[model samples]
Target: MTVATRLQSMQPTDIGVPGPTPGDMARAFRSVRRDPLTFLEQVTAHYGDRVSFPVPGAPALLVNDPDEVRHVLQVSARNWNKKTVQYGALARVTGQGLLASAEPSWIEHRRTAAPAFHHQRLEAVSDEVRAAADTALAAGLAGLVPGTGRVVDVAALTHRVGLDAVGRALFSADLTGHAQQLLDATSDAAELVVRLGRSVMPTARWAPSPTNVRLRLTRRRLDAITAQLVAERRSHGRAGSGAAYGDDLLGLLLDSGLTDVEVRDELVTMVIAGHETVAAALTWTLMLLAEHPDAQERARAELAGLPAPVSMLDHRDRLPWTRAVIDEALRLYPPAWAISRRSIGPDSLGGTDVPEGTLAIISPWVVHRRADLWPDPLAFRPERFLDPGAGRSGYLPFGLGPRLCIGREFAIGEMAVVLDRLLTTHRVAVPDGWRRPRPQAQVAVHPEGGMPLLLTRLRAERRD
Candidate 1:
């Protein structure tokens, strides 16, 4: 059978049980303003694996069990659609992009975009990724006095790196000028999405509410920027082979057999999904490496062994320890922590009855850190990923099934290049009393105040 068909065929187990009432779910949503993770944990703890929560006028399911998550996200995915509560705002900003579209449209977009992110295509862009990382690293470490200790916001640095990588790899442009604005707009959009999650009713859009205003403004700003980029690429024409600038992902998409509106939607989706998640992933990875000296040392050793003039793309796989570090970090702090789907029909999952229109929330945060699947769930252990059999069902940083991130390979490739380069070029250390920064769930989970790290240049390495 075809992979998509096989995914559709897998059925959920009939394990229906009594769950938290709609009122309880609403109360939890209110509490999420104070702490989202805690609120989700409370629901899971009180209601077991599957719990029903009232969202606006509709009921939703919060599924924490791994098998059930698999079934919802992978198996029986045909019966599920992106919950409007979560994606409606996204659609406003991104239109029918891969992240916002469902069913046939999403499948078509995925198929068309798949070739742009193919392994060979990404490999071709490796140098661009490295150049971006190097630029960010140099700028971040610049103007620091010797032995004075440079306190760099690793999250901001990674954001810049991600933006640079995406711009160079996709559009052949430098995005530094628009970085802060894009970040702010993306953050606002994410907040608006979370707020709308509580009041799932479509009335909010027509009510002239503050949320609606914010949503419209954010969408306008983001689209203006995206449109400008698209226009510039179109005007420039494709760069010749062996030139510094060539027809990349953005160029390919512009040439894709789709309307301009469709291309714009896809571009916006790529900007948000491509840059934000990788930045968050890199930030978290650096924070973990800072805490675990032995792991840092091992990663450095792996980098040291690489041939001179190494880049993130060239020797990513060669450094297993570095890859493991990234894997472990993703397990603990997935940027795309929560995904929601609505049931198209009544179904059972993890022995629970799920009614039609029920919002099914699948959280990688809960599953990846489940004690049953991961020993010492809170610990930063990269070794777990080294073992092929360890926590297969529970680990899903990029997600699963047909809707899995198309940029998965590109993100990994970019990350490996950045991490390898950073480890080899400098030694990163956090402040003595610096606690693990709580992730702020914006478009992606980012360190609340940006991840601060002490970046020390390796004595043998000269600034490029």
Candidate 2:
């Protein structure tokens, strides 16, 4: 049957909105647990833009209408706070850092952290990103013969580049020594967060279940890393005074008068959230490029026109197509796939009244795929972004408004450097009938298995 026919067949929800009945939801429980993204897509197609979810005490609504999403996330943001199960689960690892904080204190935290991402600092970060990407690419491609290509797990390499970039640019430290431990700990924490978020009846944090025990161990590992970062800085007598400390984000936080505990929270937040998201974005970009060699070649052509000894920061104005490719990739696979907010006060979204304490779930994965907003939304066409007049009303890869990610510019720049270098140095391709990896959501939406692609190294002259 058609969407209109399906809508007509289903009765309106208790709040007079379109959605599945309790029985329908109960029947789809397995699908929801297996892949919430696909389950949400199926429901939104049937029910319409604003779908209400049945919950006993909490009134839950999935706001997919761009305008309504704006109302909840941007226009009337203060009315919707991040006190939902999503953020609550994340806070187990990040504490009250900016990523999960809902209190007014986050305002000060944002202000204090803003300078670390200023234009000048980002220019400096560009150098570090280029270095990190080059180092990672060199090591990862060391074994490949000159004329042949090998299957490489691009996801792992990008994660290394992202972590090293975050360490050097943000903290003025090296994280390679702790790379394996850090990656494992963050992975465990992300899986645990997803488990808690999806649990119908979440176990208390204090419980000694296997999940909780794993959670505690993961937190402790992360805390120890944070402590090491701080201790290393203090060893150089940079912990006490702003002038004595270096000018990276770590020093800035130390000088901002935050307690040692607050510093640890912010440090861990950046170390975990910052690198993982960038890595996911780059990994998806590479996969898309591999699938669309024409787009990859076009991006390489754009990069080829740049002057010799190119500086990504200084030559950014000449790389529109390169930037557009990254934009389209983000549109397809936004790292922060789902965003949740709880209403502190009653609000109306898309003409539907959202009662106080209602939960608003906004999935970029859903919104970015809306056919009404994007022309042929499922197709991978980076040219769509080339149109200067293209509207962003339905696009939100890095979120919207005040709580927008402060490191937006940094992340984009990091991806650009890696893409430019990789496209210039090697050819990215997949085997015949190669299927895209299934998207599995943990902390970020990542390919179920790592993204493996063939990388054929280009000659030295070709890179120039």
Candidate 3:
């Protein structure tokens, strides 16, 4: 052991500060049930960055400083795991997949899944995403009521596009017809699991409550669909005389020798995370664009100049402004709002002693909004990313360290594809007196209301 190890070996010290008592915890829970977003803000304001909350079980700490967050999530990440109440509940849906697993298992699965996200594989799928955008957009526009000037449910539209893109790119299947029904079930499941995690007396999943019953049904349907998809892929593999199957993500997982059960877990995890977060990000991006017409015009001008039937991945280097706009949108509304961890061993953070089994919360929502780290943190400015190192540590839309999202590249590529499609085709605008959406904090920070927007199709691109 080195001298640095000696510091960790020293006897653990108690956190020297005061925190919320049981009564305070009770009060916060009330707010959490009522309005979780506001509850978190109130907690931070009352307790400051390095806060501790004492409850019936282990204590909880909320760390906001970037350095401290790095310490928890990176420097000493090995000593922490996803055994917290939040993640335990999340596992109800995700099972032991990458998001909910720890140690050697997570390491093994990450290694298995890593190659699927390779730039080459993503490049192959980029065309599928491009196709998805075209189809989804044309359908949405065509479905508009006759004589209506492009009123749209932007939230639902983005979701449909995201679902279609992920389906084609990952499974090579069309999740077109039953996708929304499945998506609705999965979403309900997400809300239930999150509520269970936060509840002090979180009813056992097997409990007979209506939410629990719905969650059970939802899980069964999701499992059946994923199982069917995997079975179909396996049949394709068998039919090819044990030849190399297709190179979709499901193919990659099968190739890596993951069992059907393992494949199902990973697929469902992707469906939940990929489908919801991308849609939320796109919804917010369109909303932000509507609020800032100047940025929209600039992006459209850039997009209008691109060749028809554009391939974003092929010409990504030439679309800095468009990428910057998406980046800025992510900064303002990170989908994975709060990251929670449970300390396994004793450690000190920011000179404060953190005991074992402490619930460690690092919120990207709060961190991205810190005024000191980001000048006018609430403002929409895509230029921040135009500068190198803007995203190094302070920006955490994707997060940091070993557990960083393996799908980061995939998410960015998909977002770029959708953004290019929408900006090139239409100008999104809000209705008169449309109030800005309130950021709702759950597993992700998403808009409170399903965003409604007026879309005006851009003029035909000038042929060169």
Instruction: For each candidate in the order shown, give its overall lDDT on alpha carbons.
Output: 0.76, 0.84, 0.77
Worst 10 residues of 3 by lDDT: 3-12
Candidate 2 has an lDDT of 0.84
- Clash count of each predicted structure: 7, 0, 0
Q: For residues 1-464, what per-residue lDDT tens digits would candidate 1 score against the true structure?
A: 54234323433333345465444444454457656776777777777777755333345667888888888889988888885656766776778899988646788777777777776777777778888898887788876544445778898899889988988887777787888898788767767766665443444466788888888899899889988987876677656653322356676676666777888889888888888899999999998888888999998888778765444455345767777787898899999878888888988776656678777888787787788899999999999988868898888888888788888878877888888778776788988678878777655777887888988766545434
Candidate 1 overall lDDT versus native: 0.76
Each model's Cα RMSD: 6.8, 4.4, 6.3
What range of 10 consecutive residues in model 1 has the weakest lDDT sum? 6-15
lDDT-sorted candidate list, best first: 2, 3, 1
lDDT-wise, the better of 2 and 3 is 2
Misplaced by over 4 Å in model 1 are: 1-16, 22-29, 55-59, 145-148, 198-203, 236-247, 308-316, 460-464
Candidate 2, residue 256: how far the Cα is off, in Å: 0.8
Taking the tens digit of each residue's C-alpha lDDT, what string does model 2 give over 1-464?
54233423543337787777766766777689889999989989999888888776557899898888899889999998999999999888889999988888998999998989888888866777777787788889886655678789999999998888898889987788888888888888889989988876678889999999999999999999989998888788844444646678898888788898899889888887888899999999999999999999998878776765234454357678888888889999999999999999888887777678989999999999988878899888898888765648988888998899888888888888788778887889996668889999888899989998989987544333
Give residue 219's error in model 2 in angstroms.
Answer: 0.5
